[model samples]
Target: MSLTAGILAGAAGTTALNIAGYLDMTVRGRPASVLPARAAGELAERAGADLGSGETADSRREGLGALLGYATGLAVGGLYGLLAGDRRLPPPVAALGLSAMAMAASVTPLTALRLTDPRDWSASSWVSDIVPHLAYGLTAATVYDRLTRL
Candidate 1:
């Protein structure tokens, strides 16, 4: 596939994955609302600390940054699939790669803020967070494959 084809396919895949995640989070009664003001404020402060002197928090910038991240992930994943030379890289490996990519995307919000460390996660954390990532990966691959095959 060409770059454009890869990107379009990836955008569709990621959007589907995100929709599924949003629905699952809703069903599980997870926090759908944005973080509270106080938490957001703290996070902004923490994120600002690494900036050079005179740096300050910009909520709009942070939000834009998050948007860029999603864009980047879609681009990266699509290119990766393209470079794999066959969108048909065996199901198991594709599933695992997709799972890893999804998890990488999932952890971005916190990781971007240096808020949470995956290595510090507990068994339950792995089960709850990681398992969902795996499911999303499998689902995303299935969706992409189905679409491209048509």
Candidate 2:
């Protein structure tokens, strides 16, 4: 429930999410999602940091996406800890709520910026998004629950 615990749990959760996403990609032979990286690159450009040439720019963009993802998880996890107080929701329910909240946090902004349009997303796209977030939520909630108890 503490801020430190939330951040540590969030980092773990984000790692789990990445594993789940990579597993899905391996199983389905799908390419990694480019939207987050692209968004990061755009943000960097807006911030005036010319990130270098072609492949280097791509690498930096990917790193930025990952950094942002972990940051988002830490922030959201802190919110969960703050809101849960002394009593917490059942793990399963909390996980789902966390997932939904993360999705809302992400998709809403992307949609507003026209970086992504969920309306145009295919079933597979939805699956890709949901699966990783579900992993993140489950791991986050479980870790937070354990850490708070300790």
Candidate 3:
């Protein structure tokens, strides 16, 4: 698939996943409050420090990682869709894709620090993160399918 098409598809998929996550939380009667945008902005600023020292090179690496990550997600999700009779397995594909992304992140060597702290993440945080990744995977797959017969 074309790069632009893939990105557009991925964005749509991410949005859908976000909506699904909010709905899931609501259905479970959990607090559906989003982290304050200001707080998120502040956290991003703090996270920026972790990205120390390789600004230009890191940007290129990140771009590559994102592209590779999307492709990996698409393959996994597409395979899941094909193999599993139930449609729900695509979520599992997404999970696998996300795990692969972590591996990709580890090997990419773009930044000085690993972006996410697994130890610091609660189960809820993990689920939240994975669900969106899965959405991205599925989106990538859908886009790829539309763009390429493969």
Candidate 4:
């Protein structure tokens, strides 16, 4: 039950994150990031899996990247459920913790692949990165709390 609730919460949170990102793009007129696809391609190459050439490869990478993001969100949510069980943390703590965990999970791989370095990000870049995660955290925490309240 907890796991199910967490996963549903995660789905909601992921949706919120995506909406926030799209809104940011609309407001700022910035292009979408290709880092996710690049990360997927790099990992696939490292694992000795060929994704093919030309447009097909690009499409595959994009699809894989999206799937990877979903997987990360769901896995994180499942972990949260397992950890929290029937207990509820304070709202702020849950939000911060979940946001930090998701951010770390997403960023660590890119950093490891030398794809990005958050330490050198500009203020605006940091803001762009963080705001969406905060949305995810807040939504996920709220949903989880509501669903688990008995």
Candidate 5:
């Protein structure tokens, strides 16, 4: 039940994050980041899997990248569920912690793979990264709390 709740919470959070991202893009007139797809391609290559070349490869990378994001969100939520385990952190604390965790989960791998360096990000870049994550954390924590109470 906890796991189920966490996953549902994660889905809600992921949706919120995506919406936030799209909103930011609309507001700023910025193009979507291709880092996710690039990360997917890199990981696939390391694992000895060929995604092939050309448009089909690009399509595969994009799909796989999105799936990877979903997988990360769900896994993080699951871990949060297990760790939280009938204990409720304060709302602010929960949100901050979850956001930090999500950010780290998403960024650390990219950093390790040399795809991005958060340290080099500008203020706008930070804002772009953080806003959606904040949305994710707030929504996920709230949903998890609500679901666990049922």
Candidate 6:
């Protein structure tokens, strides 16, 4: 798979995932997850940059969290693009795989840094994480397949 196609497909897929995630949040009356923002804060601290205190940090944290999410999608999409033509897994299954890969990308680092734990998540929390990823995977896989013609 071409890097260009992967990037394009990943962006499209990530957009779809965000739409799904926001919709779920609206429907459930849930606040956005803070784990990513906190993770971003940790990364910033490690880089010797203060996110500042109070509102500024909150705002930047939120924005940076989203950018990181987008970057995750791009990375996964690039991987998917590289694997696009493999016939061992059909598009539907490949979508599931892609979604899990993205989820792992988010979950692993957060957990490793002691910022979050999936083990502590509730069922709804699980749903919150899974749905958007499913949306991402399905959307990305379909787009990747279609665009790359694999």
lDDT of 4 by residue, 51-78 (tens): 9999999999999999988888887788
7-86 per-residue lDDT for model 6 (tens digits): 88789889999999899889988888888898898888899988889999999998898899999999998887777644
* Predicted structure 5, TM vs. truth: 0.97
- Quick one: best TM-score, which candidate? 5
Q: Residue 14 lDDT in model 1?
A: 62
Q: Estimate each model's TM-score.
A: 0.60, 0.91, 0.46, 0.96, 0.97, 0.92
User: Model 6, stretches more than 4 Å misplaced?
Assistant: 85-88
lDDT score, candidate 5: 0.91
The per-residue C-alpha lDDT of model 4 at residue 44 equals 99
Question: Tens-digit lDDT track for model 3 on 26-143?
Answer: 7777764323222333344566634333665455445544454445444443443444323333445544553455334332332233444466778986676566556555665565
TM-score of 3: 0.46
Worst 10 residues of 1 by lDDT: 49-58
Model 4: which ten-residue window has the lowest total lDDT?
70-79
Candidate 5, which ten residues in sequence have the lowest lDDT sum? Answer: 1-10
State the C-alpha lDDT per candidate: 0.58, 0.84, 0.48, 0.90, 0.91, 0.86
Q: Model 1: runs farther than 4 Å from truth?
A: 33-62, 105-113, 122-124, 143-150
Clashes of each: 0, 0, 0, 0, 0, 0
* Model 4 alpha-carbon drift over 4 Å, by segment: none
Better TM-score candidate (2, 6): 6
| Per-residue lDDT of candidate 1, residues 1-150 (tens digit) | 445445655565566556755766777766632322223545556677432222244454445445654675576457655675445767778667877876776576556666677888787556566665566566556655655565
